[model samples]
Target: MPVAALDDIRAKVGQQVGTSDWIEVTQDRISAFADATEDHQFIHVDPVAAAAAGFGGTIAHGFLNLSLLSRMAADAMLVPDTTRMALNYGLDRVRFIAPVKAGKRVRGHFTLDGVDEKAPGQLLIRQTVTVEIEGEEKPALTAQWLGLIFT
Candidate 1:
């Protein structure tokens, strides 16, 4: 799918635009993230402890789930030729609704919330994102994200 034109993109507001990709959240990935962020909480780093504690196993950090947004957004947006560049502006409302256990499979769903012209060939888009964990009732994260695109 090519990137939508500015007008077409704007027209996407109030429309659901969704994409999903399978990603494995492994213990190694979680541990690496923990090391990078210096967050070695037992629930996130100690599988044995976490399992014994009834969570089943160590879980990925909430921020780790948040960090996956860019990857998810790429899957959901960034269609070929839709934009020359897409810059992550920031996020709006974000919530960690559920724990993402290590070794779990997760994907994201996106909906276009708003779009605005920034320049002749640029647009600002607001998208709502939900990171869904396989078999989980609640999503891992829910966030309103922003991005700038050069058409």
Candidate 2:
């Protein structure tokens, strides 16, 4: 993670901050996510069913990919050195543009969208994040992710 002064991010708005290394979306991870969520959707859990249904094999759940943004950010984002903690505030816009098939590698690309002082010790940061699926033209998802950091 890159450490920056709290206010230093203001100038970086609209620019790419960083990108994470690729992570393989394996079947085990997908199955665990499905088991945890109790979502046995054929497209995400049953490779045979999924393969017969049109998808070459099992695919990842969109929400599973969405929920991984924090982990991905932890791997790629810049945080304020003075920050005490950060919170996953909310998202402004989110689109699942494509499916993340099993066995594909994915990575998150982050761009700072804006920053504002929400309080004396808190800063609201808006980031545009795209989860790119390797070897694919279309990204798996594009999201306007929000966070609050306490300094």
Candidate 3:
């Protein structure tokens, strides 16, 4: 991961920092998530049942979409040049505004919301993120994500 100085990161507050690459939401991937999480709701694992239920086909789980933010951040989030490591501090707010159906592609748009120097060599960064579904006006989810960077 390329790194940026703390001051450099802070300079872009309230501005979009990066956008991640698109990731296809395949049924196989959805099924794997279901198996791993034991969230085998038919709407996520059964295409027929999901279609009958009016979702058109299997829709990925909300959590599944949320979990992808970490992967998305690898490409979209900035890392302070002086940092030794960064941790997922948590999310402030999250909303699932749209369903991501199988075969759809999604990517994250990240904006630097805020940056706080909690202490020397420790920084708390907040980002506003939107997980956009391909060809859709509404995003799959939006969140206020936080990270703790240790320099």
CA shift of 70, model 3, Å = 1.1
Mark the regions of model 2 whose C-alpha exceeds 4 Å error after superposition.
none
Q: Candidates' lDDT values, in order?
A: 0.83, 0.91, 0.93
Q: How many backbone clashes does candidate 3 have?
A: 0
lDDT of 1 by residue, 1-151 (tens): 3365556666677877867687899999999999999999999999899999898999999999899887776667633256777788898899999999999989988888988787887778888988899998999989998888787
Compose the digit string of candidate 3's lDDT tens values, residues 1-151: 4468878888999999999999999999999999999999999998999999999999999999999998898888988888888999999999999999999999999999999988888889999999999999999999999999998
Candidate 2 lDDT over 63-102, as tens digits, reads 9999889779978788889889889999999999999999
Model 2 scores a C-alpha lDDT of 0.91
Which model scores highest in TM-score? Answer: 3
Error at 64, model 3, angstroms: 0.6
Better of 2 and 3 by TM-score: 3
lDDT at 44, model 2? 95
**What TM-score would every model get versus the actual structure?**
0.89, 0.96, 0.97
Model 3 worst lDDT run, 10 consecutive residues: 1-10
Give the winner by lDDT: 3
How do the candidates rank by TM-score, highest first?
Answer: 3, 2, 1
Q: Name the TM-score of candidate 3.
A: 0.97
- Model 1 gets an lDDT of 0.83
